[model samples]
Target chain A: MTDDIQSRLDSIAPLIVDGSPHAVALGLSLKALTPGRAVMGARYDESLIGDPDTGTLHGGVVTALLDHACGMAAFAGFGAKDTPATLDLRIDYLRPAKPGLDVTAEASCLKSHGLVAFVRATAHDGDPDDPVAIAQAAFMITKASKLAQERARRAYTEGRME
Target chain B: MSQVLIETLMSAPYVARFGVRLERKGNELTGVLPFADHLVGNPLIPALHGGAVGAFLEIVASASLLASQPLQRLPKPIDVAIDYLRPARAQDVYARAVVARSGRRVANVRVEAWQNRIDAPVATLHGHFLITPGQDDTAAD
Candidate 1:
């Protein structure tokens, strides 16, 4: 059941990128997925740099990726009918990422009940054992009817780009 | 090397007034927020506003970068997501930052904050900054 839902959500995942400028600017892309999991990939770019000496990526960018990844995972877990808003997120930073390395985030839905969902995710440069950061997020699901209307309105207002 | 960066950060009007200080031990940069009664956002709940903590984390991350690159101005915050682990008590706050990945264009940083208790963190920040090149400083702005 969840696997079927994940497949359907995967088809619409590209739609999530349509209206968010932050997603566009950060060069975030959705990669492959398993039944209850999703992976997001972002390359290191100049627009995301913090300091030249340390060559560290800023915390905000990581947060954005984590947030988006978690939200998408929740959407995938809940099927295509619901849109989720983040209620709260908690993160732990284990180590700083060395400069010029590709960063990847893998997120999973822990549980879903009624209109609430729980998710856990990790961000890392290469190794899962040595993750850069880990996060636990909670999301509140909206009604399917409302979400469909909102998506339609958003699509109409934003229109298609040439 | 970090002396000039520390001086510039401490000299900033907002930072100076807030009494933000930094000390480097090895590669780690630790930021200090001196205890001030006025810094407290709420007296009844006695909890610090999340925004205040966010701003402080931003400074720590920026200054840590400046310590290495003294010539560049502070990078603007593209966005910051903060997770409040616990209520910040009325005490000095300490933070440290690591540059996860620094490219020619953008930099990714992760920062953590704690009060007296090191075992428990008060908050964590994941930030993305848009790095401006040295030659195009004025033009980039």
Candidate 2:
């Protein structure tokens, strides 16, 4: 956490993601964090296996892992008070992750424009060169409901222009 | 789809963690995710974790595929594209998968997850899965 970035992030509140229950449930841990980047880790657990024949980690586990990591990056990038919400996410799976190996995901905010922040992430069990899956996502920088309410209130005050 | 396979999917380790239930009413099948405290992402808003909900939909998609074919191995997710239409409130969620097409090697599925109303979905997932269909020799053992 750099001073310039920390100063900006200070107002963001105790990161909306730290120690989240699903992350806790998945045993996801924050390995590293910077201004607009984050790395998370999750150890392979048999209980999370999706393919019994292959003993491969479930795709859902990878989805949650990558999603959280992406959110972390977006939150860190936005450095705002409100929580970031996923507007949409797209993941491309390259191959099945090796069983019994710990998985690590690295995510970074690609760009932030207006109310949306774009992020990308990759999950790899060992080598970064070969990723298990790749994720690209956009997250709303502010709580969506607040934005909707604000728009509605403005509409109410200004009268329905449309 | 075989009843035994359906039971197997519902009992799978990963799917079981979310307490996902699969039920069939005549020709229809549904997936349910019972609400639990651990599934909450933002305690401030108390919203359900997007990842949790996303994962639930993936399982539902997989289960739906399994119900239609006698695949030799569990289908592996190739990719998923999800759109969060609304914030998932804290409550039991229901999801159903519609198989757009099932090809020789791949299957396309569309999944919708909703809480209160079926038409108003919190999120929807579209994905392709690699299906390896064959006999389950292990079942004999």
Candidate 3:
């Protein structure tokens, strides 16, 4: 089952990459993939600075990145086709993230019962032991037909194989 | 228009950069944050970033408390819980907040954001603020 999940995740890499703009804008790229789990990282950029005195990255940007990562993890767990909308997300900020530091998020799907997927993610600047923020999120899977058609159209327009 | 709420938010250095505007109708308070193309979630999708909506909610929640007590000073948010119901479309976002309860030490406020349609809220926020009483009373009215 783990191997199968990994294979399914590999196939959707391009789609995940294309779906996240905040990741792209901040230079956050996929680092690893597996079924129900994904790792994404962003090289710190001065452009993403929120506070100058503390060199803290804006909380909004971090939340966006975590949301996209959690969504991807939920999508991967679905195995076939699904569009997940965030139902709720709660984040706890442990400490301010300094600018010019690379950050990575490890997102894992805790469970998927019926149409709802539960996920948890932790983001760290460098040391995994000390996380900057931790989040728990739930995503609701919608019908796949319309979203599948949209993805097909997008893939074709963007010259990517579906 | 409550001059106190408007002046208070505009005076804040960080809030000023976001270009937040306050609207008042009797006792109700509405805050608007204009859409900037750069803040879009996905350039291709062109939806308002969820994080931006969260920040706007915090500001609106704080401002709403100030508007409710025009004679008192504003409160500082100790914590805020935001639930994103739907993606905010690429358009100007409008937020309205109600002060649920205000006490000497703590205040609870609820804020909701929408575009043109109020029936469907894109996001909702419940914030708890720490009040600093008698701070705004120093101003000469």
The best candidate in terms of DockQ: 2
What TM value does the first chain of each candidate achieve? 0.85, 0.80, 0.86
lDDT of 3 by residue, A1-162 (tens): 777777766766775655545455556688877778878876676555544445566565566677777877887766535656677777666776766788888899899877888999998999989998788888876443236436655765797655
Q: What C-alpha lDDT values do all the predictions have?
A: 0.66, 0.81, 0.70
**What's the residue-level lDDT of B101 in candidate 3?**
90
Write candidate 2's Cα lDDT for A48-88 as tens digits. 88767678888888988898889888877775333478999
What are the per-residue Cα lDDT tens digits for candidate 1 across B18-125? 577888876668999876764543333354434356557888877776654433555655545676667666788999988887666677788899997877988887
Candidate 3 chain A, which ten residues in sequence have the lowest lDDT sum? A141-150
State which candidate has the highest TM-score.
Answer: 2
In the predicted model 3, the residue pairs found to clash are none
Compose the digit string of candidate 2's lDDT tens values, residues B1-141: 645666666677887887988887755779999999888776555678888988999989988988776776677789999998888988999999999999889999999999999999999999999987766433433
Instruction: Give candidate 3's error at residue B82 in angstroms.
Output: 3.0
Give model 1's DockQ, 2 decimals: 0.06
Candidate 1: segments with Cα more than 4 A from true spot: A142-149, A153-162, B1-141
| DockQ for candidate 2 | 0.42
Give the per-residue Cα lDDT of candidate 1 at A137.
85
